[model samples]
Target: MRKKKVLLVLLLISQFIVLAQDYKFGKVSKEELKEKFYPLDSTADAAYLYKSRRTYYDYVQNMGFQLVTEIHERVKIYTKEGFDMATKAIVYYTPESGEDERVNSIKGYTFNLVGNKIQKEKLSQKSVFREQLNRFRTSKKITMPKIKEGSVIEIKYKLISPYIQSINDFHFQHHIPVKKLEAQVEIPEYFVFNKKTIGYYNVKLIKESKGGRIGDTQYGVNVFKFDEDNIPALKNDEPFVSNISNYRAGMKFELTQMNFISIGGDFKTFSSSWSNVSKQIYKSSSFGGELSKSGYYKDDLEKILTENTTETDKLLAVFQFIKGKVKWNEYYGIYSDKGVRKAYKDRVGNVADINLMLTSMLRSAGLNANPVLVSTRNNGVPVFPTIDGFNYVISMVELTNRGYVLLDATEPYSTPNILPKRTLNWNGRKITKEGNSSWVKLTSSKPAAEDNNLMVTISKDLLVTGLFRTKYFNLSGLTYRKNHNHLTEESVINSLEEKNNLEIEEFKLINENLIGKPVIRNVKFSSDNLVESINGKIYLEPMLFLTQHTNPFKLAGRKFPVDFTTPWKVKNMVSIKIPKGYKVEKLPESIAVGLPENLGVFKFKVKESGGKINTICVLQFNNAIIAPQYYNALKDFYGQIVKKQSEKIVLVKQ
Candidate 1:
């Protein structure tokens, strides 16, 4: 029976190998090139015919073991939209080892069928370009010579790195359909690694061992193989997603330990746990070491604290001073660049240098403060305690009431407890002076609020003239300033007029430069599209231009939770003055709806009093993130809002 089972396994493995052999480089099948559309996903612009990766470690005489990865991919373009697939870019990090850790040995071919003949064009060096992304990363871009619809392209490359402990994540799913995917990782028995599978899709795994001998010592190569077939595309068009890549199906490997018991070498741990990772990070000269030095901004901070007797006043004073003292260089990092003192003198620094400097100044003021390690919006949320996870840093100060306020001096519009949208990911790790750490929520406890008040006047000519005023508060105000502060007056006016379907003659924006104050925008506009007149009867949308015509959540089912970034509320009031000779014929009924679990609420009411008809709508969401289980409820909640806001009021000739 055991022999039979072994034979069955070997047969399956041999069959898989035979299938892989059909997809070798320079061997594009005619049928694959002639294919019109993918079978699994008809909407896919292109499909990955076969994707493969083989990664292992190579030991050197003196330098130690290095990481090597071999990659191959074949794709079929079904339409002009798939032209983007013709260009491939590989991003690699440059470290102390230099050129050895880069993408090398790249070869590509584009094949097209012309009258039963395959015309192939080789990828030229002129088509390849290398660009430096930052101090540590670079990209290699390769554009194929010729590509068109119904063409198949194959590319192969190798990545060599001296850092065996650092492994790039292998994606199991992509934005387009993948017909077949195979990934394998081989590690020596002396090394230990922790593997975590991310995203909603599940993958199949197989483990095997091959025995070998080195210097009379027997070792085993533990192989981890992943296989998947017919993976549909991961649609990322969902609304309010912080980062879609974070929810992608992929594999992450972290080096846990190097056990040399068999090789008679020393054992070491890389990133083991949160405490260890925090300590390892704090030991770096760029982080904890930089925080200990304060002579650069000491004099300035002392003056501010002395002038402000209260702690809140001192906190605000120090926060503003940091924002003015140093400007962000538009780089994200947890490690300081050129140190804080140098940044203070030059008035330019990265996220770490500015926020760490802020934390140090708050400490110098006798307030309890610490540096928080963060992952930006583009950087996926960190689910595990790995040193490579966080890419940003901010300052957190503790108040006497035991509440803490997070501050990021990198943003010009960020208020205390209200951070930039990019920094408001899942959570951050707060590191104390002792190098101890704990997870802290990055979102604010307060809700962002937007209030809109509109006064509408209807003319007998069926034109509507109105004054629209709106105010943004809390994080809402920060978002407005971030988006509109640098925009030109004419551009802002144009955008408002286009969005509201009106012609604006007067526009006023107040408190745009004042931090911690609500931003107010008032516009006077005339529109002919707001009212429809038929048979001496006027039909007007009570909500006017602000009607919720469409719902943002359109997916039939969602795999990931909706991320709103912050709890928010919207309050809208409309006062519509009917024409002088017209009387109210009908009005939209008042309605109120609430989401399950007290997650959200919507209250809408309309009243006709005296000469004015008024409508008030308040929508409040208490939670920023709505779980996938509540997706249907949230969808229904928005549906009700749309239905209520779309109702029209009828005004008849009296």
Candidate 2:
């Protein structure tokens, strides 16, 4: 009986293995078009039946050895929600060498089952569009025709690139589940590239060598193939994850060195070390070269510096001047789009143009200032040395009293030493004009703090009246002002009232326009929903509207680290006046809980004195980031916070 059961299980397993379709271009099965839903994942709106990418070298006489990448994808739309899968985008790079990447021979087909016959719809040229993302990147987009439920869409395209250093990356998993994925890279024997793999999926790698001839020269090609089956979709629903792309199962080829037989078999490096990349960027005309053109602003800068004797005053004046003149065009880049002088003249430029001008003015004022290249939070941290590692730049000044401070003028509400939260990813590369560079920590040493004071009275009718005052300090203050400055006063008040379910009498924001000052908000509110009366007994949540109702961490297990970006602290004090002739019945016990290693702390205390209730709560997060192992502990900590905050005070009729 045991032998018979084992044989039956083996047969079932073999049947399950045959479900994945073969990854081939223009191969669409009628069964795929007739399927109502994906069996592997019924909750998935769409599924990639088969996807494959092949990148190899194609020798062209005019373009030399150009890189060629071909992609083939087939997707099954299970429902109306899967219609978005019919639209596809191919992104390519354009370098400063004036050689750009191209996408050609794009073809797409949509298959649908109509009355037991396969209906085919070909993608038209009108459905294709070309969009330029930036100075260095472009995208080709196409939308398939006749997309509906139970439809199968197949797309194939060829990408030709002149830049060999940018081999492009391949992602096995996407927002939609994938049944099978295959990626191959063919590199010449003379070229050496370091392959980087990230995420939780294990890939099967196969390597082989082939001989190829270009003109009279013969060379060897090394091919590496990676295959992955049944890759689940990577969801970005997790809170505090740096970037979903960082955790996606993918592979990238970074060119480490290249030795070409046509070039005398000498190994030339594209990017070997951090210092080498720094020096190369500093030599570029769009970067360090633009900093040397301070002569254009020498007169204006010298006048500003001469008026201010001290270094602090001079630096502040220069920063203010540059910030007031240059308006960032909402573009993040480490290199200038337009030259610094031209950008200064235009009064509108990218991040690099604005910060490079700040660095130049500081240099003209004889202050020690340099440009720090940073990768933004969405860009993810660069684990290796490459020119594309950094995406943003900020000015750093050496202070006599406090070592150094980072400054970004991209935001109008941003003060010196207070960088925007988006740029606080990891350590940045601080490069000077003298071809020197070093790693600078991007973490803030100061904690963002918030304090709240509440004075309230609960009436016998279950209505609560309150006056609240809140203060925001440091980055918290900057964030508050930046977030609320654009909205009107009435709109802001309405939003606050709606969020807390309160009727506001008056609201005032103080110190919003003052730089380096704390922001204060004073509000007067009344709410009838504060307490519920049951059988002549009143029950009310002590923390009231200030309570954190939901724990942000909800995943069963997290494979990536949680990034809070900045340490923070919050303090709340509430004094409530009980109704006349009412006696205290039940009070929540005082609770104090902290995370391991003092990473975070939460405290709640309540006391009844002089016929009134006073509650003090403090929450502090000392670390900006924590490992995945601490996820459950933090989640439990937040759970405790929610429970304690929701603890009610029950009072019977007296």
Candidate 3:
């Protein structure tokens, strides 16, 4: 009996230890409050002591059944950087849905150790703020009170949402280390959902068929639980990573089908295909419905489009006309807010209104046009077929030669084939009124180029005078105009002077009109710091004013590929007049180098002819993307270019 009693006591002790390890809200232990740093990761500024999220259905009087979620989190801060975690933002639905998502029972507290005693501070009501995020969203923001190093902060809140389709995604990893995380969701048998887990880390999922009761109805439910411990922080330390959300470890619930016993228990699928999504969007009042009715712009479009003009001319004319009339309001959306008629009268609208108007004008001119839905670079890539995948829209027209030209009227300086850089994320879905929907590559085929000519004379005193002219071609010109055309001429000159530290005069810009022409700039400058006179030798860099000072590819290796977005080329032709009665003592050797697989090339050539030194440097990239395996070669290529550009051009006096 004595031995059995000892074994029983040991078993009970083990069960107690397991229960103690499970953290609960407001149950912060004395050890947690006294912990100065996390044992597993001392470098962590903050650590999540416990995080829990429970999602289930609740019944309301008027709303019938709605999705409700309750969240609780406790964090221990050990450094000042961790103070950023004190601000909490919970985004809710817009007011247009006839009912807004409600948040209630928000509580927060801070605990700190002082003189071997616990200090408690309660969150104030005034510290909570409500703000409108956009036309479709709002956020509840809170700042924890009395946050300090070695403080423990705990918060709890409840959310009731009317949108079951927008299931909350639970993240297992965040910017700070998480010691323990627990997430559970109870789904009734009537609803079928597809769960998707994404990221570099593989997570184990647990599911069980549990019994539950809701509003006097007893039924079987599926309970899914995910419990993890010691989850490290996720950071985007790699180069060329456009969207970090793509590589985050998280799980999302997508409603696929739902059944109701009152309605004969038939399953209705909410999941959509490309064709169905396009059809539904077209049928909506704000999308294709607005496109079908263009009578308000009939008078203007009739004057804009003519029958005698060729198809290409008519297409360009219509695009230009609409682009001139409608100004983008710097908003992104797939549905029209003011309708085409109202937007035409107002002369300002969101992306969909402007692009849809463009499509309407093109179709009226006897050309086939459609709206292409796009996801910007900041918007993560669309890995699944869902309505939330795209946030932007542009117009696409079919040409006479069976080619397609993509057009975005939002950018005033953009041309038929050139689009803004934000629209270059992966692929876009093209949807037409004829029910033809397909994915189109968003990458541009046109190359960006810059050509320069520099003529300079070096005096005996080391003072140099030069005349420089540059022409930007294709997308390069468009980008320049968009960036600098807003500034005054004097402002531009002053900026250039300050940047190069040279006296500038006679600054002239050609094609200031900024439409369908190469942008050219002419400048004359004088600089005395171009050469250093040391030990009876004048040392100068051959590619003065145009030399690449530093290599942008500084990392020895990278985990992600480099994205330039467009093929590009730079050509420099320089002429330097040697000082009077002085001859060139040393010159860099002419060399040609190419990147692996011929992706890029660099050529440097220097020749002395008729008392004048001429140098030409050309760099070209065949494609916009460079994979990770080629990172080493690309880095070396830039290193060599910088070395050659910085070589000393020595001159000796006679």
Candidate 4:
């Protein structure tokens, strides 16, 4: 009887331990939450209800015990002005767990407010881990029955959430006055635990005034605050293997003020995760057996070869075919079960799958094509051969006679010769057959082509006839082509006319055949009352309203590099035929200007011959990137050019 009683006590103790080990996140219904926390301001225009429950457990996987979390969230927004508020929110859960059963510990929160101050009314309820939850409740009370115009009203709120988790929520009981006030909210997305985990959130605009700009009043909630120590530290567990620990994994929320607008609402999280281990898992599975798939090639090599005569022609044909046939879905992820061949057959995929297909196809065609990994400008810079840092992929094809061509099919307007601006980072890595990668140059030595020409003629009545020609090559040319393709011809001409305040009579564009080649635009127009008549004399701009002077460099001190990839060269000529009784009374002296080291050059000349005053001006900038150390010299050079361009010529009429 004593032994049986002891066993029963042991069983009861085991049951208690099991119950204590279980952790869960639960959601309270809207009615229940409202009943629990009633609003102090009954006349408030908006109300919100939000609840989240998080549960942690231990599970056995491949190596050992790992932590698993199941978090659930729900939110409701109420407004008296109707449900027009835009609200977007999201939650992510890690699909896998690591060696530790408890992967993360809750952290703290940083809150900021605009248009009003905030105060805490009550502290948060404590948890099992003795984690102190900070709760803020508004301290001010409103007793006034009516709010007067031009009166400053204070807005306040109380915020509570896990310190290790990102919280972006706003609650207000009054309508935001749109006439004289604005508001903004910024929140950090990550919190610190022992190991780094990826997190993301969703943002939504719930209520908005009709016909108002949505984004103008709404911005991202996720604002990243830089921390020097928050960067993941490299751990040397294996030889040459480093692991980064400081990482925030989550989406952010953003809000902006609108024109004379007031907003009242709440932001809530629907889901979340503690870490991001999918990157490595995905790379290993997808690329391992990609080549064996069927229907990988669109057509046999013989058929494709018969369609093209020359190598360049074949290359262009293949490029165009791929661009037209494959659709860009704009999804970016390191892992997907769909193989490259399957994606190619389906006619859609992310950057990695599509660019990898391009590389493979080129290799199959007996060409030297390699997949290059790069971190886009928006994605930050790359961290060398870390492998996990790259988020975008592009292809580089080598030509026997020519050099190399970089291609990104995702960029629709990008031509064969033009590389996208996002890829102009420090460098990229070329993935080779043996799994070895080499550094590749992302900058181009070739400069962008530029040309500017203007011709002006003036009559005795001050009527002006002007002809303008612009030619662009390389980067300059690519930019124009991309922009021009998006707009109609009439819109382009109208824009030019409006900018110059002239009545355009004719406009024409040429050089459409050469992809990524120089683009040329020719425009002719006439305008009356262009010259000012003062004190019985007419003063006319020598270049007939053309911008003859420009400030290319603006930095005070030059310690940074100067960019000259997009160089500039302009030429202007103005011929004013003397009216029957008019002759040149005053002509500005000719001047030549340039940087001391020949960094740039500018020149202006005036001459009177055959009853005509001819004014000529020229300016050229040869560098693409300039250093801060040379900024003063460059600035002075441009200043002189501007003065010369603005010089006026005096004309006397008899």
Which ranges in model 3 have alpha carbons more than 4 Å from their true place?
1-52, 59-65, 73-86, 95-98, 110-121, 145-154, 173-180, 184-186, 201-209, 214-239, 259-263, 306-308, 596-598
Positional deviation of residue 324's Cα in model 4 after best superposition, in angstroms: 2.2
Superposition TM-score, candidate 3 onto the true structure: 0.85
Q: What is the per-residue lDDT of model 4 for residues 1-654, given as tens digits with 9 covering 90 to 100? A: 999999987885454233212112231222322321113323323222221222221223443212233322122222424122222112222233221112233321111122353211221223112211111111212121112221111122222222223223221112311111112222312111111213211122222211212334432233222111111112222211111111122222221212222334334322221111122222465542453232557574457767775767666666665666566676544332256866777987776666666666666666777767776645544322233356677778888989887777766656664666666655776665555556677655555556666666777667888787888776667668777867888998888777777888998888854664568888888888567778878787677657545575554543334544344566666676666777788888899887755667788898888887888777776654454566777778778877776777788777
Compose the digit string of candidate 2's lDDT tens values, residues 153-245.
Answer: 999999998777778777877888887787899998878988888777667678999998878888889999988777888877777877778
Q: Please report the candidate that would top lDDT against the real structure.
A: 1
* C-alpha TM-scores of all predictions: 0.94, 0.95, 0.85, 0.56
TM-score-better candidate, 1 vs 4: 1
Candidates in order have lDDT scores of 0.89, 0.86, 0.83, 0.49
Off by over 4 Å in 4: 1-294, 300-302, 330-339, 383-385, 512-517, 548-581, 585-621
lDDT of 2 at 119: 89
- Candidate 3: tens digits of C-alpha lDDT, residues 1-654: 999999987885454334336466666666787778776677889988888899988657656678999999999999999998899998887755477898888999988888788888888879889998666778999999988998999999999988766677768878777777888898888788878887666567899888866567777789999988777776665455666676578887877778886535565777457766666677777888877887888887777655437778887888788888989988888888777888889999989999998898788778888899998888777666667778899999988786899999998988888888888888888898887788887767878889999999988788999999999987898888988899998899999888877899689999967588999999999998788888878888888888889888877676566777778899999999988877889999998999988899999998889888899999999877787899999999999999999997888887
Cα deviation of 69, candidate 4, in Å: 15
Q: Give the residue spans of candidate 1 off by over 4 A.
A: 1-21, 96-100
lDDT winner between candidates 1 and 2? 1
User: Candidate 4 versus the native: TM-score?
Assistant: 0.56
Error of 4 at 320 (Å): 2.2
Ranking by TM-score: 2, 1, 3, 4
